[model samples]
Target: MVKVSIFGSTGTIGKNVAFTLAREDTVDEIVMVARPESLDKVKGETYDMYDALAARDIDCRLTPTCNFHDIEGSAIVLISAGIPREKGMKRLDLAVPNAKIVAYYSRQVAKYAPDAIILVATNPVDVMTTIALEASKFDKMKVFGVGNHLDSLRLKNYFSRHININSSEVHTRVVGEHGDHMVPLLSSTTIGGIPLKYFVEYVDLDITGLVERLKNAGNTIISKKGATEYGPAYAISNLISTIITDTHKVLTVSCYLDGEIENVEDVSLGVPAVISKRGLEMIVPIHMNDIEKRNFMKAAETVREATYEVKEHMNM
Candidate 1:
């Protein structure tokens, strides 16, 4: 039986992820952890989820706690505990405070769940992922951030809508930062196994507008709802399912690079990686246009600078 532990279970994303994972037959148990002050909120969520599970006839076990030690026996540790992005704030703005929180829990996870795969969902996720990897001292493959995976999904959704095709027929990805500087790999985008550019020749697609919308997608939702819940929650659960099912699918996620792609070293950026039961199997190098390559390099620098700031705070 596979058990997963979620930190910051009281948050919107955490709660939604808990519900989503609970419905998976492969997930036998879920441990939800929140700060001491929010323990009641997690307990309420657990009871609420139990009712929902009973209605569906699912047998997934649920445990709620304020204790970090209870995270033991977890196969996957999801860290979503941090101050969420505000209406007008950039993801990078939450770096230091969130990094401290992530670092504290990362150390505890290292101690309590040494062999678990760490999935980080904190804002400025690219930086926070690097922080988790460093603080936990976990293998790079065992620690990653759910970064461009959502952005890639957004891109896929856009292509599907514009081309009037099922979303599963579109294959595309957004790389680099999970924020403003993210690069849409149009060069590699495909629809029905054909290059997107080929379809562009026959379809009237506004490439510029689509990319702009993709970049602003998160803030657009946050400006109205104060937080993005379902989209990220589902996206995270999808990645976890891939790992738990041992599917060697290539997905874009923030992972540490040690001179892996284009000689880029010592930073975690969203790149295509093969995810399986062991976490990342390999980082797949995709073809990028000259302009896309430049934009990607810039995005790397953007994340690297923010990561440096948080590293200073942690004195790493």
Candidate 2:
């Protein structure tokens, strides 16, 4: 059976993930983790969303509990259980508190389901991914952050509209951070195998403004709504699907750095990576211009600073 456990299953991303997976026939068991007091909230919300499907008699199991032991035996664990950032809140503001949560859950995972693929979906995800990796002592490949996948999706969608092309025809990747420092690889981006520069020349689109729009996409969503969750839930669900099915798809996710990209160290940042049954299989390196390289380095610096803060608090 394809067993899955979602930490913070009562939260926006977690509940949406459960709702999405509940609709899938491939998911055999879903364990929802939350506080004991939150059990009814999860059940009520889930039933309210799935009652129609339940009336139709779907055959999937939805188990809600406060116990971490219930997460054992699951093939994948989606860590969406941390504070969501407010409109003006910086990623660093979340570092210390979320690091403690990562530590707590990492110990639980180590004790129970050490073999499960750990998907980090918390804000400041790149840094939180490092905390989870170190605290769990799991293979770096098995721990990854849902980073630029959502950003890349937004970028492609924007590009498609600008060039009047189908979104599937546009292939793009956002690298480095999952935040404002993220670098959109315009040079490597393509529309139907043609360079984005050529497409821009043909369409006369404002490339500079497009990059800024991608950077501020989350802010725009948060400004409209209270928080951004739907896009992330969709992106994370896709990652879970890839892991569950052992699909070796290349995606932009935050993985541990080992001096691989320009000697970047001790941080997790978004880069093109292959994901399969073994989790993150490979970090694919792509050539970038000087400006893009600098942007990536700046993002690495920000992640490193946050890591240092977390480490100081953990005394690690």
Give the candidate number with the greatest TM-score. 1
Residue runs of model 2 more than 4 Å from their true location after superposition: 55-57
Encode model 1's per-residue lDDT on 109-201: one tens digit a residue.
999999999999998999999999999999999999998999999999999987889999998899999999999999988899999889888
**C-alpha positional error of residue 153 in candidate 2 after TM-score superposition, expressed in Å:** 0.8
Q: lDDT of candidate 2? A: 0.86
What TM-score does candidate 1 reach? 0.98
Expressed as tens digits, the lDDT of each residue in 156-198 for candidate 2 is 9998898788989999999999987899998889999998877
Q: Which window of 10 residues has the lowest lDDT sum in candidate 2?
A: 47-56
Model 2 clashing-pair count: 0
